[model samples]
Target: MAQSHRFWNWIARRYARMPIRDQASYREKLDRTQAVLQSDWDVLEFGCGTGTTALEHAPHVAEIRGIDSAPKMIEICRERAAAAGCANASFDLAAIDRLDQPDSSLDAVLGMSILHLVDDRDAVIANVFRMLRPGGAFISSTICLEGQARLFRQVILPIGNFLGVLPRIHAFSRTNLIAAFEAAGYEIEENWQPDEDPMKAVFVIARKPA
Candidate 1:
């Protein structure tokens, strides 16, 4: 985790400068997410790299706290928030498991392009479930490699990681992701794959039962 943090910190600026692959589709996802957010709600976003998504949704909520393990990422996030004049959004350097918020305190939790990188998906989901108020939402976009050829995902991705060509990936199927949410006591409000590409990114909006 330390090594990962250092790497991300070193690349924070470059990562921020990179262009979104599908701007139109990404905008659509943001719009859909913002549409469901309430102005009085308090939101938390884990693995919020550079705080882009949180900043985007900041205007729709009363407060948004974006957390990332990388200090430089959080620094960049703060810089961006300042540039955007987003008073309601803040960034912190913290791990998901280390979050100290009270149980049932948040109105929503968000994770975008992050679920697939976590080492313990179930534990993370459980924590997120614990943090939300009843009827709160867990909104996310996850990159799933489960649709790829088993040999390539299982063997090639590992080799790529060893070669430093790719970051370690925790391949998850869309079905399993939804099941994980349900197992954590969330009701699936929406779930769908946004792209037909082999990377298989999935968007999900799940609500805790009131």
Candidate 2:
């Protein structure tokens, strides 16, 4: 975890400057998430690098807390939140597994491009589930690396992470991901893949039973 933090902190500047790889898809996600969000909702967005998504959703919700393990990432998030005058948004240097949000408290929790990088995705998912209120949403956009590039997941990614070129990645199928969510007692409200490619990000909005 320390190594991952250092790697991200080292690259924080370049990461902040980099443009979104899929602007259209990003917009669509924002729109979809906004559709389900109420004005009085309290939300959490873990792995919120630079606070873009949380800040974007701030105007729609009462409060949005963004957390990341990297100190530099949280610093950038604070700067961006301040520049945007987002009083309802907050940023913190924390990981989802270590977060102690009261059970059934948050209205929504967002995990964008993050679950795959975690050391224990199921535990994180369970923690997120515990934090949300009944009928609350757990929205995520994850890169399922199980398909298309089998060799990349089995070989290249592990080698890259060992060589300090990539962050820790867990390769699993979309089926496996959905199964985990269902096992955690979430009701799948939305499951979408932007394209036919299996390697593309899968957007999900899983709701806790009300």
Find the candidate with the highest lDDT and give its number. 2
List the global CA lDDT of all models. Answer: 0.87, 0.91
Q: Total backbone clashes of model 2?
A: 0
The 10 consecutive residues of candidate 2 with the worst lDDT sum are 1-10
Error of 1 at 23 (Å): 1.2
* Clashing residue pairs, backbone N/CA/C < 3 A, model 2: none
RMSD, each candidate, Å?
Answer: 1.8, 1.1
Off by over 4 Å in 1: 1-3, 149-152, 163-165, 195-198
Give the per-residue lDDT of model 2 (tens digit) for 1-210: 555786688789999999998898899999999999999999999999888899899999999999999999999999998898889999988888888789999999999999998988999899999999999999999999876687888888778778777787888889999999999999999999987568689999999999
